[model samples]
Target: MTEQLPDTISRLYADPGEYVDSDHPAVEAFARAAVPSDASARDKARRLYTAVRDGIRYNPYVSMRSPESYRASSVLAAGNGYCVGKAALYAAACRVHGIPARVGFADVRNHLTTEKLRQSMGSDLFTWHGFTEVFVDGAWRKATPTFNDTLCAKLGVKPLDFDGHADALLHPFDGEGRAYMQYVNDHGSYHDVPAKFLMREMAREYANMQGEDLAGRDMEREATEQ
Candidate 1:
């Protein structure tokens, strides 16, 4: 899409749907708690990125059971989510604070995924991996709030960072110098998460990991065992 006017972009970023619900009380409260009134948009975006990155525990064993699980407020209230849920929360929180934000997806290979998960998913390629693109300083910057600090440490991979300027993409190597991740395909950005598209992709790509849904699957245990 072409560059949108600031007001138009802001409107596009705000949503009241199953995913990226900025109007929800929990998401509003979270945005309020993560950033102060005096903070600049860049500062607020950084704080929100950090808050979502670390605050929400990442788990993939659970199912996407219903539309509610995709809501930013719902994910915030639950205190844990996978990459999609975490990114949704970050985008929602940004919109709640009047920061233009959108969700972007990519097919990633060899992320800090565990052997069990890799086998369960039948491949190392994870489709629809989510991230936030915050509009700030006259340009949109990408940030991946997945893989919290502890998880990064456990996986021996450097934690990703975003300064509200450069893109905080996945690292190309682990701590031991092994190739860590690569973005196989970019699905572009969207004001709202394409939930049906994501679900269908998950169903096709993660059939072995599915269990009625894909929300709370325990990934920490697998990570720890590695």
Candidate 2:
């Protein structure tokens, strides 16, 4: 059976929460412009995803958080943070617009770019970042708007775009088959993503564990010397 989103997700859109209804500015302006009664799910989902993607960035500073002070408009206002920040903005907008959305991640074997960069020194970097997953007509589609042009240019990649309907012409990675970031965990069944605020605690947990294991081996060697 296909996955179906809860009906409450729709209710939330009509009866927005404190943040969505308030004139806090961050989300107020964005919510007004983005949501349209006649727009299809794909149109709203794509616009929400792209709005965040084209607005925010993929910084390492912002904490892995659900929408707090930041919402759809936050990307337009503060305009910082990385994947996590972008994902939060995207999700908040989707929820506000009655589009059921969730966070996701992929273990990228290689982050390909139009050209190689100096910062990409080592091999197999696991930046288990955050993105948004929206339930369309039948299937759920993945989107990452956080890596906008500025960040992509710095990282030597292209900006992925998503117009209000179809995916925009700016998707960075090739998502068809080759450049796929593997999805092993079915939403924390095996892996964890911090965005969900549940089942998955953090996206970096697995990567952090690997580093600890290496440290343990080095410690053992030093103990032998002592």
lDDT string for model 2 (13-89, tens) is 33433323323455646754865758887777776665666655544433334343233345456666545455656
> Candidate 1, TM-score vs. the true structure?
0.91
Name the candidate that leads on TM-score. Answer: 1
Give the whole-model CA lDDT for all candidates, comma-separated.
Answer: 0.81, 0.49
Runs off by more than 4 Å, candidate 1:
1-6, 15-17, 211-217
For residue 50, what is the lDDT in candidate 1?
92
Residue 226 deviation, candidate 1, in Å? 2.4
Q: Which ten residues in a row have the lowest lDDT in candidate 1?
A: 209-218
**Per-residue alpha-carbon lDDT of model 1 for 82-187, expressed as tens digits?**
8888898999988887888888999999755888778777888878888889988777889999888888877877778888888897888998888888999999
How many pairs in model 2 have backbone atoms within 3 A of each other, for residues 3 or more apart or on separate chains, i.e. clashes?
8
Best prediction by lDDT: 1
